[model samples]
Target: MRVKKLLLTLLLAFAALGSVALAEEHKATPAHETAASEEAAYESKSLWKMMTSFYDTTGLKAIIEPQDGVKNGLGQDMSKFSQSWGRVIMFAIIFFLFYLAIARGFEPLLLLPIAFGGLLANIPIANMTGEHGMLGIIYNMGISNEFFPLLIFMGVGAMTDFGPLLSRPKTALLGGAAQFGIFGSLVGAAMLSQYSGFVDFSLKQCSAISIIGGADGPTSIFIASALAPELLGAIAVAAYSYMALVPVIQPPIMKALTTVEERRIVMKTARKVHKLEKLVFPLLVIMMTALVLPDAAPLIGAFALGNFAKESGVVDRLSNEMQNSLINIVTIFLGLGVGSKLAAEQFLVAETMGIMIIGLLAFAAGTAAGVLMAKLMNKFSDEPINPLIGAAGVSAVPMAARVASKVGSEARPGNILLMHAMGPNVAGVIGSAVAAGVLLSIFK
Candidate 1:
């Protein structure tokens, strides 16, 4: 009788413990459910108001009607129409900004196309670049597997001339120096991820975000697509925005660094680059780069292929296509697809603003680093280069080079070194890609 009573008491104690645990778990579940539903409810209402207003203004009301089957991982199954409105309004704002820049004679060439692409890409309905939509399909075909960036590389190679860099190897260091911004931006992204409340960016997203400072869109896209596709929208937007803002950002630094006479410094025209040098340089570069940093194979290989096709005196048809039709077609889909990623769910947050600010700072720092390096190199070399050329070290191609040239011209009429700047311009390309590879290797 004593043993039986003892056993009964133990069973009663265990039952009480089990009941308490079950009650706690049951209580916790509802709290979570309540919070989630509240968040979903708030987001749905806010998004709905924004979309309806946008449709009312643009006569796209038909596009904003209720629909089904678009699951965004939010609480409610978000309607495609609403998401489309978000894209449309955001894209339109970007376009209007682009036009304002153009009217002000700001960076038009790049801003106009990128802004317009952002708008067209955001159109709802099929949202051609999202899932199964045609543009979305093409976008995936181009970006998912790294085709668009390489194709863009071909065009870049055709348009570039390396004579200045070959003639002046010292300028190469400036290109390398400017890449510190890329690393710095990576650190910034990591910091932001740690602090930002909504989305915690992964290591890959931080790495991809860092490439915005490279000042090369294709490189940004390539790195982002490879490591952090989620960041592609922001990275691309930030890269191009700073590229467009180069005129605004670079001028203050350039003026601060040099005296009027320094800005007016003249450079001799480069001697003719023999056909052999042009053809052999790409091959030698690829071999050396591959040996040193095999991680850079994709970008270097594409760059070399494009350069070779241009200089080989063969495959004229292939080179022409790569330069014009191929790049254009890829760019259209690439732009639209990249632009489409600017959904409100993705952008319109503190983190997005942080990325943009970090990117601009990186660009400014890169430009300063390049110019300072050039100024330092002058102490060691007999041949003097226009310090302004250092500004082109971010690899925006002739755009950056042109900005340098334009700034110099403002200081001194008849100053021209756009072609000479191309050397470091292309060098910056190689340097940025190498930096990107380093980040991927370390972080990815």
Candidate 2:
């Protein structure tokens, strides 16, 4: 009886607690309702304004009134000009690059990514080229730090066979001669700066711009980053564009420079280079670079390591990775990083026009110089040397060499100048790097 009575008391106490809790919840309901009502009222009042605000944040609005403080190459405020027209021009350029890469089969591997990155960079609100963005991150990681170009040099070395150059040391002179374009363009840029009203390139800027003549994209980027980073976009684009247009650009110059008989001149096959010589060559080159031009040691060292790996025959896996996978990956990042500089404010300048014009002339000068050098060498040589092979002296690699072979084959039915051209072609790679080192030593 006592237990039952205690239980009933406990139940009555629990019922009282429940009633109090329900009453408190009922009292809080109006506060929650009031808050929700206020939110609804605010939304109703500002719906149109919110829609308008969203519209203002859109790409169209951003392009029409690009965020203020846009500047040109001369450090003048260009916000007025940069409004919609600058972005439109950049878009046109991006699309043109796409056309070249896809439809025209230009250096698609690099050009495609670069074009896409340009598209990203020009998207105003996205700020893809800003410090915190994707392209900026990539640019800082590889390009600004000068990592990508060196890795590319390593990959190039791994892929390149110095056998042809080793077999005929004379071809190194043709490669060296091709670098005349770089120096000649330097003088041209300096002259343009002095004479042209629109262009104002400093000596450092001239140094950076002239590297476009090397026809070596990575070397150009390296030199530009070190010497005149402001001109990097124009220089890189010029370098790669000319490199891609090798077939079109070089053939005209080659044919104009050489006679049909000179093109058809059959050179004897070079003696096969021994494995020991091949192994020793990169070491010697690296040692010479270290002793003479330590500035070039980084590039030459990377190249030598790759070549050593390839020649060792023991590190075939490592060599293959450097040549194929490593290079392919770096090329994608390098392209995007380079394209990050293609923003409207950065690329669309009077200086870009100057860079383009000077770059073309530089390339022409290099080609002409190489062809002329070969002709000069041929005059003194016992064995016949095709003047057409000298055109491959621009560091465009196998493409230039292949063009030489194609032109040679056209002149004479089945003559293969591919191997012969490769000697100077590979040598041009070394020559360009050495030239970059010299520029860096002087400018940096």
Candidate 3:
């Protein structure tokens, strides 16, 4: 009987606790629902405003009329129409680049990201490449500091084998000769500025544009960032676009410059290059170039360090990381950062047209000089060089070299000149950097 009484008392207490719990939940539910509704209303209003921003001046009014409620604003606002049209035009340009990258397979790795970033940058009302934006942060972090291109050069050095140039150091002359194109274009740029009112391109801007002739994208970007940050985008695009078109551009030029008989000439086998020579080459180049042109030290030093780490045999991990993981990472950012500079206001001007013209002239001049220099070298050297290989000195790296080899092979069924062309090919990299240093010094 006592137990039963105790159990009933316990049940009554539990029932009372359950009633209080239910009452509290019931009281809190209305407040929770009200808070959720308020958040939803706020989100819907914000979304409406965002949607209306796109049609701000497009003569589309009914879509946003209900939300705006205010009737004072015009149905068609043309205040910022030019900028809006500029964005539209930029989007079209980026899409065309996308087609080139994806559909046509033109330097897809870099071009694709560049196109995407351009797309992001020109998106009206998003401010995707504005200050503190994702692309802006990326650009300021590496490109503005002029650091990423040097990093890319380091990666390029790590992957490059200097054996071809080392075996036949004379071919380095072809590389040196090709740099005349850069200076030639400088003169052309100056003339354009002096004669044409289209652009008053300063010597600095001319230097940046002329570097495009080197056909070295990283070197081009590095020089442009330092000298003419304003023209970097147009110059980079022209440089890379021309580089991608090398096979088409070079073959015709090579064929035009070299006789059929000269193209058929076979090169002797390259002498065996010792590992010690390979290891010391980068150091020697850095010390020599840096001493002569301190301005080039940053780029040359970084390149030499990368090559040293690669050839030293003790720093395999560092070399691997630089060539593979690190370069890939930087390439993405570099592409995007460069693309950010292609905002419509910057690209639509007559100055960009001038840059494009100057860049083309620079490349053509470089190619012609390289070919002519090779012919001159042939007159002096008993070891007869295939003049076609001289065109590889423009520093498009393996692409220009391959074009030389391909042209040679077409002339002579079994003739192989790829390795021979590579001698001048790698030398062109050093030559271009030196040219950039010279220009930097002159203008400074």
Q: After superposition, how far is residue 67 of candidate 2 from its true place, in Å?
A: 5.0
lDDT of candidate 2 over 1-444, digit per residue (tens): 453455456546745654664574465456556645677667643664464467567665565555677543234454655556777778777877877787778888888888888888777667777678899889999999889999999998999899999999999999989999899999999999999879999999998999998999889998898888778888888888989988988899999988898988999989989999999999999889988999998888899999999998999999999999999999999999989888887888999999999999889989999999999999999999999889889889989899999999999989999999999999999999999899989965
* Candidate 1 ranges beyond 4 A from true positions: 1-94, 97-129, 192-200
lDDT string, candidate 3, 325-367, tens digits: 9999999999999988787766777888999899888888888
Give candidate 2 misplaced runs (Cα > 4 Å). 1-43, 70-78
Task: Point out where model 3 deviates above 4 Å.
Answer: 1-82
Give the TM-score of each candidate. 0.77, 0.88, 0.83
**What tens digits encode model 1's per-residue C-alpha lDDT throughout 1-444?**
443454456546745654664575466456556655677677755565565455444423334333566544223344454465555456446745555546654445445555655655555443444567654676677888878888788787876677778876677887887887788777877777777665477777777887888999899999988897867778887887788778788889878887787788888877776779988988998998778888788888888888888888788888888888988877776776676566554555556776787798789878888888888876676887778888888877778888888988898899887877777788899899899878767763
Q: What is the lDDT, from 0 to 100, of the residue 253 in candidate 2?
A: 91
Model 3 C-alpha RMSD to native: 16.4
Q: In what order do the candidates fall by lDDT, top score first? A: 2, 3, 1
How much RMSD separates candidate 1 from the native structure?
17.2
Worst 10 residues of 1 by lDDT: 57-66
- Of models 1 and 3, which has the larger TM-score? 3
